[model samples]
Target: MRTEWSEFRESLRRWIYFRKVRFKRFLKARRAKQEDRLAKRNAPTLIPEGANIRQRADPRQSKIKRLRADFSNDLEETRFRFKQWKHFRWMRVRHFFQAVRTRLADMPSIIGFFKYLLHKRQRSIREQESLSTRKMEAKASSWSKFRSIYLPEWLRRWTIGGKPKSVLLAFLLLTSLVFVLAAYPAYGLLKALRAEQLLENSRELHQKGDLQGAFRKAHASYMLNSETLETFRWLCETAESINYHELLSWRQRLADHPDSGPQDRIKLVRTALDFHQPQVAEEAIRNLREQEVEPSEYLYLRLLTTLAHGRPAKNAAIRQCREILSLPAPPLEAYRIYWSLCLDSMDPRFGREAVNHMKQTAAASGAVGLAALRTLLQLPFEDEKKQRLYSKMLWEHPLAQRHDLLLSLRAVFFGHSLPETALRAALGKQYDRLDNTELQEVTSILNNLGFHENATDLLPTRTMASNKELWVEGLRARIGSDETKETEKVLMEQTPFTESERRFLHSLLLRKNKEFKKADEELVEALRMATASDLPILRKFVLLHEDKATLVALLHRLAKEPAMQRWAQALLILTLQRGAEDEPLEELLGAIQANDYRNNPETANRITRLKVLHGQDLVACRKIAEGLVARYPDVREYRFTLALCYQESDRPVESLRLLEGMLSANPSECPTQRLIGARALLRNGFSSEARELVVGFEKINLLAAERRILDYVLTQTKAKQKGPVLP
Candidate 1:
């Protein structure tokens, strides 16, 4: 068994040795292939030594030699060109330097000039060094003096003694003293600066119309420096200007201050007089008079005191006013007081003279002149010529030429008999300068004056679509005119109105043309997209509905809305009354009365008419109608109601008289008034007069009920056979 095992082992060893030698030979052959590939990749091209000579023996060799010769010649030419280029560059540089040298040679030696500059630089450096040394010496001397004065030898010894606790305490105490001394002045300076900054901010805030913020800032400034008279003066002036409640307190402060100057006292007195505290103004004036006040100032205060206190010394006050005006450049306050006294005395000549003088002085008197001019414009002169003259003078004044002044003029004289061209010129010239409020006022004035086209033209280019209703009113005014069709054409072409406004305006135009159904449909669509402000237009459109039930239903829906409640309720009541729904009419009237409809004249009139229609309380109806007539006499509807009340109360003569006056004033304007007048005439046995009135109605567009009444009146007149009776 041992021998067999030995043989197997020997076989295994031989197999292992054979495998190892085969693997070794494989690796060596692989390495040799890789080396060969590397050698081939890196090797240079090789040629036989006689290959060139063989090529040279051929004709192609001569071509090769010629090519070589050409290449050599080109290289030589390139080198020669490069050398010439370098020579040319060097010569140009040399010529430039030679020109500079020639230019310098005509002036001064370059080296000597440089030497002089160097000398100047050295001298500057030396001077700077000397200055620095002198500064250092001065600092040293100052330090020495400080040490000699403040730091005694004993104190220096104590500092150097190295008693650690004592040294730290002394250092701390001295540092605290130094900090306290430095910080006290710095704190005062910072407070003063802060107060000054606040004052500046207050002025800016006041200019921006932030009166509350300005008051706070001004108050803080005064609190920080109560001794500053200017700060106190500003606080007082601002308080008075903004009508702040603290005005009295600030004025008292200024008056009480010992350092208050004559100007401060004068201001305090003027503010007192303006606030209607004559006693306070008198005392202030007395104090000022004691302090050597100006003659004009004293006399002005005296005149003001006299005027404010009911003119106790009227003649003396007038003489004082005259004295004040006699001064060169008399105070504006004097002129203002004199004008008031003249007005109170009913002296038109003197008042006119004062106004003329005020106008002449307004050019140079700043705010005072503007105030005087405003007062003059507000005067109630009966003569139109005088009014026009005053207005013209005001318009010509430089102070009155401001945009704000123009707005003030419009406010004061919008409804008065001012020249339209002059007013229009003034407004148009400064239209671009108006702010939003002023612009809105101008547009409203233009609209009220029947200048709708001008108002439309003056609308801002960038107005919001939400304000299209205002522009629509202008367009509504153009309806039925020659421009109406052209306006509609232009509106169709342009999109100035929003989709809703355009629809609403189209509905309005359609309604004017009597296309009710289409207009109603368009209006419904518009109302769906309409804002609250658009409800009035919608209400007017809804009122034009021929279908009473539909109108009532629509009005009922609108009445449910809080914003449209009042108008819709009134409209609904009228619709119900017109439909002869008396049962619901009483409940609606009670609801309206319960809801405080008396505050509105239309609703109250409706209530009165309902009462009259019911005949429940004719006396109460008459009283209410009379009250309405008295309250709004200019309102034709109220007067018509009163006429109806008079007719219903069996006073036919009174009713006829009222109706006749109405007819005379507004001939055929009010159909209801004409109808009532015919009824009154028929009842009063003036059938011929009734026939004459009813005949006028045939030429007008009358309602069915009105035409029936007219026909009945004409038949009754014919039956009576009354001929041409003048009642």
Candidate 2:
């Protein structure tokens, strides 16, 4: 044990010695580096041989020396001026004291002369006072004699000679004038009071959901006091609650009123813009410009006017918008205008910068920020960074509503690589706040996007669970699920299903289960309980069934519904063409033409297809196809249809020409168009070109029908390749 301990201690000592030596080496190296740095920093400055050292000194140092010398000279001059000013001040003080001494020397004589003159003036004043008293007594006596001789008794008794009755009559006349002057204000006060009362009643009615009563009261209040902006706002709000037409009328009324203030007119213009009534907005803005308005308000109206003019005045609008936004603290409307102009430009960079500016500015906490966020969602952002930044801003915005967040999430979902889990969570939170109708819409959108589980999880846990309409939608979603059989069974066993709705649900489930006869029976029962509005539901059932009799019966049944008559007739035409029932289809077309419904593009297109399919009136079908091609030159389907029409009309040259144009325009029509084009080429007696066109089409995964068509074309080309057969 002692030997082991000795060995361990020796090893420890060796390790300690090695560490010390390494530490010493490191310290020596650090010291050497410091010394080398100091030596390099203090290296001698290079100088030309025989050069003047003073002249070659640093320019900065020389400038500093010159500044110091100039400052010293300025200090000396300042001190010298101070001394000269003090001497001048002392001399002025001496002169002031000398003048005072001279005045003191002349004071006694001046006082004695003044005393002698004062005694003489007092004696003269005494003599004049006695004469003035005697003159006054003589004048008074003469006036008394004159009054006694000229005055009459009737003049002494007149109202001007102190009669209280005339005084009272004059006072009453002045009082009457005052009352007349105040009467207008008194009437205005009474009307204003009435308007206030009416507005209060309107509020009460609005709260009670009596929108019509609220509208009447609010309109009455506005008529009573048209000058009050609040009354006008209440009127517009009430009208909007009642109906769109009413709101429009109120907006026009307020805009046309001569007495409306700037606020009223501005609100009118804003509401018109919001409702996309640009004409009304323009008229309101024109009237506002004609009236007196503040500078900011005038600028705001100008921005609105420029925006209403659209792209024609975009440059001017952008300049004015930038100027307004450059103000120290511009109004929220200025930010709104900036964003509007940005959106109009459709420049994603401008949108991104404007959104960033809005986020940093005080406008981000208010309606301006909300508008910016909404606009940001509409902008086509190309960068994922900007999209994520905008998403973060929207998520953290204090004023963002559930709808706003959901829209932001949707924007991010489409524009960025945000996690689906995060999007689902945000949508789920908003789902809880949405009303029944909004929930239904959001759920449908989710289902359509294939987020079935997320949509099912987002269902409302409260009143919506008991909502019959929502329950039906949920069942439909389940029926569309992968586990349709199980979901259908669950739906069948559920309680609270209406008889008509149960029949409808059962029909859908039966159809999914391939029990068509039972499904048709259920559908008929459901149709019996259905209303005119249920035509869409019945149409879905018709589309599911392949039986010509079932489709015709459904169409005939739907024809009785006035709202569904036209739709039913269109569907009947499609059904007849599908079944190749030429006579019935022609008769239906004649009836439709008699009704002038065939003039519609949809009906005309359908009729053209029917003629093409039935091989009847190929010339007329070609004419219709030509018109379709002319009307929709860019639509490939129209062009293809025209090609088909040409092919069937025995105009294979024209058909091949159209097909060649289609292929040249887009060669990616690898299988379908090439097959058709090859057939057209073969029909046009170009067997070699046709063989080359479809040489490799079989390598593609062609459908059985496509393969058969290709095989027939190839067989014809091969048969023609051999020499003519001997008879």
- lDDT string, candidate 2, 1-727, tens digits: 9999999999999999999999998997677667666754686766677987666443333333555689999999999999999999999999999999999999999999999999999999968865765665566675553564224323344434456887768767887999988998999999999999999999999999999999999989988998886788788888878765667667777666776667777877777766655557667767765456766677776677556544434556778888877766667777776766665443343555665665565245667667676666656677878767777777778887655666667665662333657755666655347788877776666554444555556565345645755665565556545556765665656445656656766776777788989988987887678666655555544543445666786687787788678768877886775564657777666555322343344455556655564455677767777875675464455556677677666787887777666553444333545666767767767676667668777666654445665897889888555322111
Residue 133 error for model 1, in Å?
32
The TM-scores, one per candidate, come to 0.34, 0.37
- Candidate 1, position 712, lDDT: 70
Clashing residue pairs in candidate 2 are: none
lDDT (Cα, 0-100) at 557 in candidate 1:
63
Looking at model 1, residue 461 earns an lDDT score of 41
Report the CA-based lDDT of candidate 1 relative to the real structure: 0.67
Best by TM-score: 2
Error of 1 at 103 (Å): 71
